[model samples]
Target: MTRFPLLAGAALLALATSASATSFVATTDTLGGLTANASESTSDISSSFDDDKIVRAARDDAASFVASNGAIRGAQLEAALRHIRQQAPQVQADDQQLARAILAL
Candidate 1:
């Protein structure tokens, strides 16, 4: 019957009612309202560790940390963690994962 087709069409329309999210844009005014975050440690551990273009110190630190089988935590390992946090602030992980990512690079 015609009623069945109308019901099916109504159901399809109801299923297609997903709305798009478009309000996440940060306008200039919104950006200006935010304060500068200076509490975070700004020291770059690899600043002195780099030479030319190759990041050998990070690799060495990661390699040494890996050589310890993750049982030993040292200044080199902490340097790797600081390097990871400085480069990728969004990364939320424990020491092992960050070390693995550093060595994997």
Candidate 2:
């Protein structure tokens, strides 16, 4: 009878719904583990690179130079570089990262 088919379809739909809910719970647990792992690694990296005193001083000096003159050029460029080197002697003129960091300021 048509009623029998309707009842079978309703039962199949309920089973499918319950199966999907179980799969979703499993997927959510997996995602939670991944999120925890990522958070731990992110904290480790942040603590490792948390600014050094020398780098901080150099950035401050660069900021001051920019504030005072509006733009660095010619002898001013040399002076800014010299000031940074004086504060942190390890920084070379051609050190790309330092240059980029200072310029970003």
Candidate 3:
């Protein structure tokens, strides 16, 4: 009976090894063919933000507004939003969004 189990186990092991050999080589071949593009690039996300005159203009006001916990709105902040739109009409953010950005700073 012990001999029968040993033979069965050996047969299973041999079958497993043979099946794994084909799949293992196949997977390795596929992996060797895979590669990343050499021209892939990355950039700083903050560089895309509109932090020029608009963000700078709202800096002082933002500190106060942030300190007030969103309760206070400053005149300079409004002016900054208007200035941003005029200076760069392509800007698509709304008034509250612009103010929220300042509050973050």
Q: Judged by TM-score, which candidate is best?
A: 2
Indicate the residue-level lDDT of 13 in model 2.
100
lDDT of 3 by residue, 1-105 (tens): 899999999999999999999999999877664422111110111133346666677878867776776677788877766765675565455455555565544
Q: Any runs in candidate 1 off by more than 4 Å, and if so which? A: 1-55
Per-residue accuracy of model 2 over 14-77 as CA lDDT, tens digit each? 9999999999999999999876765554343334334644344455555545565635334434
Write down the TM-score of every candidate. 0.39, 0.40, 0.38
Ranking by TM-score: 2, 1, 3
RMSD for each of the candidates: 10.0, 11.2, 11.7
Tens-place lDDT per residue, model 1, 1-105, is 999999999988766663211223445445554422221112222233335123345566667677888766667667667766776675455566555555554
Which segments of candidate 3 are over 4 A away from where they belong? 1-54, 66-70, 103-105
- Candidate that would win on lDDT: 3
Candidate 2 local distance difference test against the native:
0.54
Per-candidate Cα lDDT values, in order, are: 0.54, 0.54, 0.61
lDDT of 1 at 42: 21
Which residue pairs show backbone clashes in model 3?
Answer: none
lDDT for 70 (candidate 2): 38
**Candidate 3, residue 102: how far the Cα is off, in Å:** 3.5
